[model samples]
Target: MNPLPQNMENALTGSQSSHASLRDVHSINPTQLMARIESYEGREKKGISDVRRTFCLFVTFDLLFVTLLWIIELNVNGGIENTLEKEVVQYDYYSSYFDIFLLAVFRFKVLILAYAVCRLRHWWAIALTTAVTSAFLLAKVILSKLFSQGAFGYVLPIISFILAWIETWFLDFKVLPQEAEEENRLLIVQDASERAALIPGGLSDGQFYSPPESEAV
Candidate 1:
């Protein structure tokens, strides 16, 4: 008989152990254990790429909506009013609504910045947060002077700050990588444990067969 490869031997042992475990599992609490395992596997299947893609789609749709609003604000007005009477009517209706649209645009940008901040890696969050917060603060100061409108200038920053806190506190936006790392570590540990269970031991003969150890440099 041909000698089995070390990996093949290990796999055979593991399969036997797993079959035995399944029998024991079925004898005990089969339903609850199977359900828990299925749930964990499903969550792991969702993965990081799926999450990133979903976030990207949301950001793209929001940007497109903001662009549509801008088009409506600029094109639908026909023309600026020449007469004082026409100007008053236009300002009251079109101008006021257009200002609100601009405010919406500001809000959209802030929301994007907040999203970028949240998605930053563990080490990158500090720099990303600092940059975004500073830019929002500076934009508020400059736009407040240039536009001379308090609502248009400050609304974005105020909303951004609130959203930043929510991301940090509720969503764990900053800590996702850390959580993922810990999850991967747990998986490694579990895999190692399962592999260890497959090792052969307690032979009757004086001679022993064991898995080879890797040589250290």
Candidate 2:
């Protein structure tokens, strides 16, 4: 049987060494295995640039916008005191963007935890927030007497609905997807390079090679 060419032997050796190191890593634990699988090669680039800023701003705006709408609607509904007397003190929860504002605040804090603390770059966080917000807002729009108020009442729900959808679109289509793709792409690296060689020579693909004097057995 013919011996492997020098380049082929070197490539095989390099591959085996890498695999051996990986095997040692896997023997340790599952966490170590995951860490070594990507070798943290692209961890620093897992998410998009300014992901923290963009996502925080989005949640901030959501909370603020809902609060603004609640304030205006509150005044139109005879101020917070009257509304609380009727909506809360009377053992009934009313819809005037107040509940949405509270929900937005809660959602903001949770999203901050997911993105800033846990460093999740996936769309799940934003998708979940959007879904819940939409459901609540939709239910309120249906049950509430906002249409009897004026243009402001009509516009409030409409704007809130639009904003919630916009948030989903921004994350699912643009920010989160790009970050997720980057992370996934990095994790999808090949086990070994097909063109790797220990000794560099002007060798083209599919060409036969002779063993050099230094590498010959």
Candidate 3:
């Protein structure tokens, strides 16, 4: 063919250069992609390393809270010797404000247990722990109404409830095992992008190029 126009030749050369680059990217190894995912997960876990320490601190405070309640119960109600005198000063755990506090404590325990389970990659453990914690708290409430009139007896469940929830929220972003699977499914999108970049038209979907595979996918 006769010599093409200067601009058309330049455009064709540029297109060829771009196509070569895209092909280079599309030849990526799947193993490398998986390795990148593992690297990211390791870094993410490091960021949450202090979750256990936080749980311990909350548990310590929870214990102190229970002890304080016991002391208050003993002093306010005649040392548990006189039942009639004890009734007069016992702060009713069932009263609206106290009831709300109990619920809050319970929710906190749920949070703690959930996070702990997420860290362990055991969702069933989380569910079982939550059920046991709830059941224990419910039993305490029932026993308090039936057998004891004072608030001291109710403190353990409240403390347990608080501990569980504190555990849950500690690592809210810590992905459970199932969530990791779901997340891996999205990783295919990254591979597709890389393949598109080295193709003749780049990404025909009008998508932008993915960075080097070494970069976080």
Clashes of each: 0, 0, 21
Q: What's the residue-level lDDT of 139 in candidate 3? A: 60
Q: For candidate 1, write residues 1-217 as lDDT tens digits.
A: 4445655767767766776664443343334444555655665566433444454445445445544544443443454343333424565432243433344445446544544534433434433543565565555545444234334334434544444344344224534554576567557545544544454432232232344543333
Instruction: Name the 10 consecutive residues with the lowest summed lDDT in model 1.
Output: 201-210
Highest-scoring model, TM-score: 2
Which regions in candidate 1 have their CA more than 4 angstroms from the true location?
1-38, 48-130, 169-217
Preferred candidate (lDDT higher): 1 or 2: 2
Instruction: For each candidate, give its TM-score against the true structure.
Output: 0.36, 0.56, 0.38
Better of 2 and 3 by TM-score: 2
Residues 84-161 of candidate 3 have per-residue lDDT tens digits of: 234435555442124323444554465455554445554454456556667756765664462364555555456666
C-alpha lDDT score of every prediction, in listed order: 0.46, 0.64, 0.52
Candidate ranking under lDDT, highest first, comes to 2, 3, 1
lDDT of 2 by residue, 115-202 (tens): 7778776778877877887887778777887666677667766776777777777766776766666557555432222122222443
Query: Candidate 2, after superposition: displacement of residue 199 in Å?
Result: 7.2
